[model samples]
Target: MTLKHGPIKNLDMEGMTMIFAVAKPEILKTLKVGDKVTFEADRVKGRLTVVTIAKSK
Candidate 1:
């Protein structure tokens, strides 16, 4: 997935849009363009990855 995220001070990352790999590919089916979600991300296998994600309640 690709995301435009807020600044992540821990990573010294500025808010910017970037592509990420997901930990679980099945999760993609539950989402559509413009869906609001809360997620956890990290570097997995040296690539930025979304570890978990859920629709905003």
Candidate 2:
């Protein structure tokens, strides 16, 4: 999946770090820690970080 908004925090050869806010629970479920992802926020386009994953159980 692609993220439409977020701030690019850190980056490396392997991947990048992104800090974005999401509202949909369904979308959050599809993500996991260390998972590779794509970011698309306004003019920014590149890989992102699944640095952390939080869910309600």
lDDT of 2 by residue, 10-52 (tens): 5323333435444334656766765555542322344333434
Candidate 2 regions with alpha-carbon error over 4 angstroms: 1-18, 42-57
Please give the CA lDDT of all the candidate structures.
Answer: 0.84, 0.42
Which lDDT tens digits does candidate 1 get at residues 11-31?
Answer: 578888999899989988888
Which residue pairs in candidate 2 have backbone atoms (N, alpha carbon, C) closer than 3 angstroms, thus clashing? none
Badly placed stretches (over 4 Å) of model 1 are none
Q: Residue 21 lDDT in model 1? A: 91
Report lDDT (Cα) of residue 29, candidate 2: 73
How many pairs of residues collide in each model?
0, 0
TM-score per prediction, in order, is: 0.82, 0.33
